[model samples]
Target chain A: DQQVKQNSPSLSVQEGRISILNCDYTNSMFDYFLWYKKYPAEGPTFLISISSIKDKNEDGRFTVFLNKSAKHLSLHIVPSQPGDSAVYFCAASRYNAGNNRKLIWGLGTSLAVNP
Target chain B: GAGVSQSPSNKVTEKGKDVELRCDPISGHTALYWYRQSLGQGLEFLIYFQGNSAPDKSGLPSDRFSAERTGGSVSTLTIQRTQQEDSAVYLCASRPPGGGTDEQFFGPGTRLTVL
Candidate 1:
């Protein structure tokens, strides 16, 4: 079963526009969420993250908003640049009984920021 | 100063052969994880390790797959008697001490092709 889902397989947006990517989770026990961006043939890089306790977290041009009740979260990149074109993955993790964190990943969304 | 590193960026082998993938996590990071990505399976968790504790092998697909971490730093994943279906990109990631809050740094991944 896929606990985390990124329904959109691909997204296209013009440069300097707003790009929003969405993700949903089925496990309420997941208390932390993160976003990663990946380029072709490269590993994913950490982007932004948010805790379930907070509704939103922002860093520079990127922002993550979480809605606990809806079991959904989204990453917003404002004034998107062509450099932002990459596959985006939304991940969720929970501290297991042993105190180690285990991550559950989504299928990933490929975002294309056109210049 | 370095992020997670993985070796053998690409590997091609015949079916029935064995393959070993290696990962070197960042210095001072205590957590490590392995994931597999394939066209048919998307992305799935394989295993995880934290310091000197026992690894979480619940995500391993079968007995043929196994992993080991030495000195709580480097890790290696071994796949025995590989089949055509064993082809995929193996990704390694690492996190710091704080569970559920730290971001995971990922390696470029090793793409394995079993012919």
Candidate 2:
């Protein structure tokens, strides 16, 4: 069974609009959540992260909201630019028996911004 | 290097052939991880290394997959007797040692095509 899931395979938004991507997880042990962006032929880059203790975290035009009770999280990009087009992956991290943290990843949502 | 890098950006191998993918993490990073993404699938964890401890290879799919981190820096993932189902993009990520969140830096990845 998938611990983390991104049900939407793709999302499209016009430049200057708001784009929202959603993710869900089944593991209650997950305490840290992160988002990564990837362009074609390039490695994924860290975008933003939120701890389970907080309900929301924001960086400039990007904001991540977590609803712990619902087991859901969403990433919002305001004034979306064409440059924001890429695959967005949501990952959750939890420490295992060895005291080391490992990430559980979602399938990723492909976002396209139209200029 | 400034970022994690993987060698042989792309590889094509015949079924039953063995292939090795290498990763060079940023200097001083003590944690390394291997993951793969098959078409339309999420990133699957294969293995992880931290400092001088034995690697966490619980996520490896089968005996055919193996990885080693030497000197606690560079890592190599080897797939033995590759099969067509083994085709995927292998990614390497590194995490800096600190108290910050569990964000990881990734390499461009090696796209493997098995025929």
Candidate 3:
């Protein structure tokens, strides 16, 4: 079963506009959430993360908000750039579970930011 | 050389053949992870290794799949008598000494095609 899900298969946004990507999870035990960006033929690179204790986390133009009650989380990019065009994957994990903290990923969403 | 490195970026083999994929984690990183991604699918966790401790192989699909981390630095994933269903891009990631909270850096991945 897929523990994390990204409903949107693809998204297109204009440059300098805000881009929003959403994710949902089924497991309540997951206390940590992360977003990763990947390019063709390249490994995914870490983008941003949020802890369960906090509802939001921001890094520069990227912000991630989590709603525990709804089991939903989203990543927002302000003034999206063409460089932001890539596939984004949402991952989750629970700490203190030994090596079980390994990440569970979502089917990625391909974001194309048109210039 | 600075980030995680994987060998044989692409591999094409006939059915019933065995293949070995290799990964070299970042220097001094104590945690290593393996994942598989099929076309248009999410990342699937396969195994995890931390220091000299026993690996978490719960995500492995069958007995034909196995992995080992030697000298706590390099890892190898073996798929015996491969099948077409086994074709996918295998990814490896590594985390530093800070444990699960640390962000993981991934390698470019090895794409395997079984025909």
Candidate 4:
């Protein structure tokens, strides 16, 4: 079962514009969500994250908003730059005991920033 | 290196053969995880290790797959009797000692081709 889903396979945005990516999940067990950016031939790099307790979290140009009731979350990048073009993956995981947190990843959305 | 690293960036093997992939997590990171990403698919959790003990091996697709960590550090994922369907990029991630709330650092990954 695909607990986390990113419906958009690809997205395009021009430089110096706002770029948004959305993710949805069915499992209410998910309480922590993270966004990762990946480039070809490389592993994913952590971008931003949010806890179910908080509605929003921001780091520099990136921000993540979570809606527990709606089972949705979004990653926003303001003034998107060419360097931001990459595949973005949304992952969700819940805390249990013994430090067991296995992240469930989305199919990933390819973002292209036009110059 | 300062970041997580995987060996033999690419591997190709014939069917019915066994292959082993390695992962070296970031120094002082106590949590390790293994994930798989097939072509056009999202990342799939395979297993997780906290220190030298793996509390969750539930994600392993089949009995043919297994993983182990040694000395509270490096990990290895072994797949027995490889099949064509097993071709995918195997990624490893590491989290600090705290918990799932921490963002994970991922390695470049090993692309395994089963022919």
Candidate 5:
């Protein structure tokens, strides 16, 4: 019953390199996808998001690419910094007329950036 | 300028005791959600509330788990007769009005330890 899945449990990348985090979902009804980064003992911080209408969305150094046909999406952090090291979670949900906007989240990927 | 806040950041209780967790969403946000995260596990959706509409309790695990949003702002989640397996960090998140597709701002989470 796990709809969203993040296959990689941990990832290590060098500073200034590109760090890619991937997520897959089986629920095609989900039209919106989001990524959140979390540090130890802290709430998750918003990262990037993509709507199914488009294939990619970018803000600053982060970009989210979505492939609807494949039911896959990824967050890419270019020139990753040590500050970028954290657990990344992918969540998907559909928006209806009312308050049924429950989110389905992935297991999360722990990314470690080596300086 | 403030973010979502939850009370009793850390709580330790004996098994069979009931525990109530609280969440205060952003001032203008109209959507609120509750999630649970266990060790090495993903965020599990628990419930959702939007404005003055009926709260979505479909994700609630059992009758022992319940939540209420008074005045469409603050929310309280109650777990009755908690079991050892109920130990986990409960997270609360909120989204501003007309921002269903946007990222949710999460609280630091309330960690519950059942002995």
Candidate 6:
């Protein structure tokens, strides 16, 4: 069974608008969540992350909100640019004794920012 | 400096043949990971290696899939008796030695096609 899930397969937003991507997890143990962006033919680049202790974290135009009670998280990008178009993946992991916990990933949501 | 890199950016092989994919992580990074993304699927963890420790091979799909990290810097993933179902993009990532909560740096994946 998938421990992490991204319910949307794709999203489209006009440039200068806001874009939101949602993810959910079944594992309550997951305390660290991250978002990654991937362009075609390139590796994924880390975009942002949030710890379970914080309900929200923001960087520039990007903000990540964590709802621990709902086991859900969302990434918001304001003033989305065409360059922001890419596949977004949500990952979650918990701190462990090994300190090398493997991240559980969600099927990515492809976002298109149309200029 | 240099980010993670993978060799044989694309490979096409016949079923039942064996293949080896390579990864060169960033200098001084002590953690390496191998993952695969099948069509329309999330990034599936295959294995992980940390400094001088036994690898975490829990995510490997079958006995046919194996990986080894040498000198804790370079890694090789071997798939024996390849099946058409094994076709996917193989991704490699590395993390610096610190609290394992840091983001991982990834390499452009190797696209494998088993005919």
| lDDT scores in order | 0.92, 0.94, 0.94, 0.92, 0.92, 0.94
Q: State the lDDT of candidate 1 residue by residue for A1-115, as single tens digits.
A: 8899999999999999999999999999999999999888888899999998899999999999999999999999998999999999999988679886787899999999999
Ranking by DockQ: 2, 6, 4, 5, 3, 1
Give the DockQ-based CAPRI class for model 4: medium
Best by DockQ: 2
As for DockQ, the candidate ahead, 4 or 5, is 4
- Model 3 chain B scores worst on lDDT over the 10 consecutive residues at B95-104
Give the per-prediction TM-score of chain B.
0.95, 0.97, 0.96, 0.94, 0.97, 0.97
- The digit string of per-residue lDDT tens for model 5 on A2-83 reads 8999999999999999999999999999989999999988889888888899999999999999999999999999989999
**How does candidate 5 fare on TM-score?**
0.96
Clashing pairs in 5: none
Off-target runs (Cα >4 Å) in candidate 4 are: none
The weakest ten consecutive residues by lDDT in model 5 chain A span A94-103
Tens-place lDDT per residue, model 4, B1-115, is 6999998799999999999999999999988989999998888888888875645888899999998888888899999999999999999999998654669899999999999
How well is each residue in B1-115 modelled by candidate 2, as lDDT tens digits? 4889999899999999999999999999989999999987778999999898888999999999999988888899999999999999999999999757998999999999999
Descending-TM-score candidate ranking: 2, 6, 1, 3, 5, 4
Those runs of model 6 whose alpha carbons end farther than 4 Å from true positions after fitting are none
Tens digits of per-residue lDDT, candidate 6, B9-110, equal 999999999999999999999989999999887799999998998889989999999999988889999999999999999999998898756689999999
Candidate 1 per-residue lDDT over residues B85-105, each given as its tens digit: 889999999988864475888
C-alpha root-mean-square deviation, each candidate: 1.2, 1.0, 1.3, 1.5, 1.3, 1.0
Better of 5 and 6 by TM-score: 6
Q: What share of the true interface contacts does candidate 2 keep?
A: 0.91
Using TM-score as the measure, name the better of candidate 3 and candidate 6: 6
Error of 2 at B28 (Å): 0.8
Docking class of 2: high
By summed lDDT, the worst window of 10 consecutive residues in model 5 chain B runs over B95-104
Candidate 6: which pairs clash? none
